[model samples]
Target: MAEEKLLEIKDLHVTVDGTEVLKGVSLSVGEGEIHALFGPNGSGKTTLLNTVIGFARYHVTQGSIWFKGQDITNATIDERARLGVGISFQRPPTIRGVTLRSLISFSSPSLTDEEIERTAERLDAREFLDREINAGLSGGEMKRTEMLQIILQSPDFVCLDEPESGVDLENMALIGKAARIALGRDSFDGAGCRSIKSRRADYKAGLVITHTGQIMDHIFVDKGHVLMNGEIVCSGNAAELLGEIRSHGYTECFRCAGCAGRRA
Candidate 1:
């Protein structure tokens, strides 16, 4: 028997400001699997993530979003989140008075104070959590905080948009470590390790959107899809697709008649 599906998106069509952004997009993710969405800038990667999380501005004119076994095409953002869907925005918002600690604690009340502190430390977000949310935070700091929230929430499915954008050589390893912990790898010590492992077991599905493919090198990306003009043009194993993208950008792979003919 095949593994049960965790997320199902069928004939997904989305438009923003009267301009079509996603055209007949269809994809599925199974439990315990990682699916990578790769595309050039403005290729609708973020649009798809927003649509999955029920962003109101991007209208889903047609299609449906199913989670676990329920149709959630019209669910609100908070509704989807409570139902085990979480998203880390490519450009996270900055709330003036909200502290990172408060926001994270509010989202995940199960975490102990020490667990939260350890999580922040692993993501290199220990310093910023006490500060205003995303206020005066560097790009890497914002990314780390986003990763921290996903870890704490332990959602069934996570949507990560450009997870490695602002990371530099110095802190890239730390970010990668945190991502591995979220993916269920056992590398930490004490309660942190146990908590992360439990979260990993609970986190059965994910949609990772990346441009540089650097994240794939660190984590095991199960499948990859190439997006262009708001549509998936090609899908393949993570290793093969990452190689193609690295050698030649999305233009060469997405536009090639031969590559486009094959399904992901």
Candidate 2:
């Protein structure tokens, strides 16, 4: 049997300020799979995520975005979001005078108070929700808030950009737990230790973009792709590629094999 495709990008080309950022880039994520995208700064990781979210500023000069078997290349940001696509930005926006509870309640009206508290507690974000969206929020607090949104939305596909960026080691485990919950690996209370096996049976997919591979250490990443100069230089299994990246930095990897002479 063939695998179901959750997202498909074909020959994507993007430009910003009249300069091309993504050139002939293509990628696919299947249901329930976690795929990591690794690249150095300015390699277009965030730009790619922005394009996937249908940001009008990042023009897709040529390409197509297929989500859950439908063509959404031309869809607006709101349109894609209504279709169960969620994005956790690298720098979450601040909402002045808007409490976190209000924001979440506005986005997801179905969540009960108890459910909201549980989700917030699991993500270590219970205290921050009472405050403004990002007012005086520490790095960890911001990440937790983002995780809370993920739980509330329960999106079919999620794109996380640099989730571990400013998080400390103490809160890293909680972040991992939240991600597992989103992936359906284990529940908020750790009831389903065996659910990791069952979680792989579902069709929830995640696209993670990272500069540091710290988050990959906590989860089971299925595949890894190296992005350089706005395009994928090579693809490999998670362990092997991660190991290579650990032993040798992006500069070495770029000159190793598939991307020796590529220019941005």
Candidate 3:
């Protein structure tokens, strides 16, 4: 039997405000696969992720978004979330009056306070649990906290935006580890040691965005996509594409308008 397609965006056109941000883009990540989306600033990477997960303000002017075989072009954000889609934001909001402790408890109703403490401790977040979410948190702290939420939620399809954006080396490893754990790649070693999640990880799929591409060092990527000027200029081997970008920058392989160099 063939594995089901976990998330699919076909010829999607998206606009923020009156201006179109994504001209026409298509991509897919199958069950248990992780796809890396790479692009320069203003290339529509965040717009695409925000669209796929159905952030209402990002109106889809044309095309379709299908997740787990259902077209969800017009689905509500909560609808998409209930269908096993989860995202760790690059800049998570600072919700007033909601402590991280309360947030975690809400995410996993069955978890005991003791287990929550252990989870927070593992992420070195014990101190911030009582703090308002994202309130006074450093960039790295915000990333880790959101990752912990995603782990607890155990969404089937995950979207990671700039998982390594502002973190130092230590937090980068922690964030990477959390991402791997969310995607089910860090579940167990050959020696049978467990990863963070106590339950054996269910099959998970992911769409990850990277500016520095550091997250790729931790999470194995099955596919790579380049989006420029609101469209996907190319899709190919993740490692090869990243190496190409590193060697010559994004222009060396972009096919979009106003970009020069060979096709990526």
Candidate 1 has a TM-score of: 0.91
TM-score of 2: 0.92
| CA lDDT scores, all candidates in order | 0.83, 0.82, 0.83
After superposing candidate 1 on the true structure, give the runs of residues whose Cα lies further than 4 Å from its correct spot.
Answer: 190-203, 254-261
Per-prediction TM-score:
0.91, 0.92, 0.90
What is the per-residue lDDT of model 2 for residues 1-264, given as tens digits with 9 covering 90 to 100? 888889998999999888999988888888888889988899998999899999888998998889989999999998898998988878998889999998888888888878888888767688987898988888888998998898788888988898888899998888887777776666766686474455564746888987777888767888778888888887767666666777788767645554444322
- Top TM-score hit: 2
Decide which is better by TM-score, 2 or 3: 2
Instruction: Kindly list the per-residue Cα lDDT of model 3 for residues 1-264, writing each as its tens digit.
Output: 765678888888988998899997977788778899999999999999998888878999899999989998999988888888999999899999999989889867888889778777777788888999999989998888888888877789999999998799978888887888788777423222144435433547899999888999988898888888888887888787777778767876554332344243
